[model samples]
Target chain A: MERTTFNALDPNSNVGCGRGSGVEQGAEETIFTEQASDDHVIIKDSCDVTVTTTDIQAAVNLQVAIQLAIALVLSVSIADGSQAQKIQQDLLQRISTKQLIRQKTYIENSRGIEVTMTDAEASVSIQLLLQVLLALVAKLDVL
Target chain B: MNESDQLANKLGELLLGDVLERNGFTPSSKRPLTPEQKQQIRTVLENLQVETERFLQHSQRTIRRESKPNH
Candidate 1:
């Protein structure tokens, strides 16, 4: 949709003009071009001028799309920071409460003068004591 | 009797038998532990319990400390 005008007299201009392309030599020529559909264009005149045009609408759209994507990413990251912090705090509080309860129970059981052990607790304790005694017996025999 | 009491009674018998056998005394099936032996066994089990609890507490503390943010 963008239009570009090239002056044939400018040596730096990319417009190409051959001597047989109907452009008069030594006279400044103005060429109006629409959006270029291909990568290469050959314009010829008597002055042997050369020119090129690029699609501006596509480039502008690409820039705008990139900026919008960056803004969206920035906003999401900002929102997630506080949300992640809150979730971590909540999980830590729950774990702390459970640990406190377990510690209290453990202390109470350990401190009792005549502690009564559950079946599973008694089994584990007996197994541990057997292992210790067996190790002692083995050591005493070795000596 | 609770499971721990039964376990303790069984362990006491086993220990008494072992000690007697080591001292060249005949082991008896019905022999009960002396008051002194019972006290010693209780002390050992209590010490083991305390050590286990301390170790667990230390592990939990280490985990909690490491789980926290450094900053």
Candidate 2:
């Protein structure tokens, strides 16, 4: 088995061509060379070539980092069911109290005020809360 | 038993303390809570208590299962 690796770090185009090296028993070792040009093209094994817009490894590493960060945050937050429950309860209570006040006002007045929370608003609030919690945790060296 | 579990336990303690501090529940802290903040803390505590109960129940179930004899 023969393995080859190529790495390029330039905006300009380049091409790698592999040629068979003659050896014993009619076997040949492949030679790989890069051709610099305005258009990048990599030819490997004539039929098994991959074209990438950006560095795939770097992209994969970035994706993994994002996933790990998200997972860490979620796991830390939700690890203790009690804490999660507490937070949920607190949020619900606050929201309910607000709802109650609105209800009372509507009952006292003829005009009705709708207290609706958009998904974006809820998401932002949750994110903010998480960030605050994470910051606190970081300060304590918990993470 | 695992390192991650140990870390999680420590993290839990820290997180609880953080929550309390943010809510001005510190012992030495002399800040008065506004009505809204008080209400919020109460709600959070209530939820936490419920979650604790649920967790205890689940753990108990797991212990029982582990102790059960094979049928």
Candidate 2 C-alpha lDDT tens digits along B1-71: 35643554555445545554544433332223356654544464344434333432332110000111112
TM-score of each: 0.18, 0.18
Report the lDDT tens digits of candidate 2 across residue range A1-143: 87633221111212322223211232232433233322222222222222222222332333333233323332343445454445434433332211110111111111111122112222222223333333433432333
Docking class of 2: incorrect
- Candidate 1 CAPRI classification by DockQ: incorrect
DockQ of 2: 0.03
- Candidate 1 residues lying further than 4 Å off, grouped into runs, are A1-51, A80-143, B1-71
DockQ of each: 0.01, 0.03
lDDT of 2 at A42: 25
lDDT of 1 by residue, A4-62 (tens): 43444333444333344343344344333333333333233223322212222322333
Each candidate's root-mean-square deviation in Å?
36.5, 25.1
